[model samples]
Target: MKENVFYGKGMGPVKKDYPDIYEAIVGLNDAVYTGKALDYKTQKLIALAIAASNSDDRAVKKQISSVVETFDTSKDEIMDVLRIVLLTSGMPPFVKAVNLLYEVID
Candidate 1:
């Protein structure tokens, strides 16, 4: 059985089951932070949008926490970014992101 990446609740079997692939992705994420392509605030906003677009609630929550800690962005600004993501990525994903944000921010 695969451990859940999201809530500690049970999830089924792993899909990829490839440790090397996971490591590569982790490495790439670290690489992205090596150069300051964008300011921390902008990156946080982008991460929020991307998580929303991908309908990844865990990532949305994580990114929201990062934004709150790193940039000290207000909740309103985070909501605004989520709204923009909704405008582009549609309602369902936006709703998921909003729910995740609420769970984290609360």
Candidate 2:
């Protein structure tokens, strides 16, 4: 599995390195289960939008790639999510996210 960006390496060891915290978070998975309500395609789109809004390039690109691989979602659909993020999250962060997305997708 890929390491989490927040707790991995240069970010320093926090809850990720602690077995108790990790287990606690893992146990809390039931609190926010995504299930099959939106389907993989829609879930990826929502994830992309949220990542973009939050200015998380790694997460945005990761979700974009996952959507491409799993649901065969196109670049246009990913861009649409970015557009929505721009509307909700403002220009600067969205620009950075879009640049990162282009870097990965292109």
Best by TM-score: 2
Candidates in order, TM-scores: namely 0.67, 0.68
- lDDT to native, each model: 0.72, 0.68
For candidate 1, the C-alpha RMSD (Å) to the true structure equals: 6.2
TM-score of 2: 0.68
* Cα distance off (Å), candidate 2, residue 92: 1.1
TM-score of 1: 0.67
lDDT of 1 by residue, 1-106 (tens): 1111333122222224756656565566566554377765786588679988999777788788877876677879999998898899999998898888888778
Give one digit per residue, the lDDT tens place, for model 2 in 6-92. Answer: 323333454547767765655554333354575546755886788788887677777777767777777787778878888899998
Pick by lDDT: which candidate is best?
Answer: 1
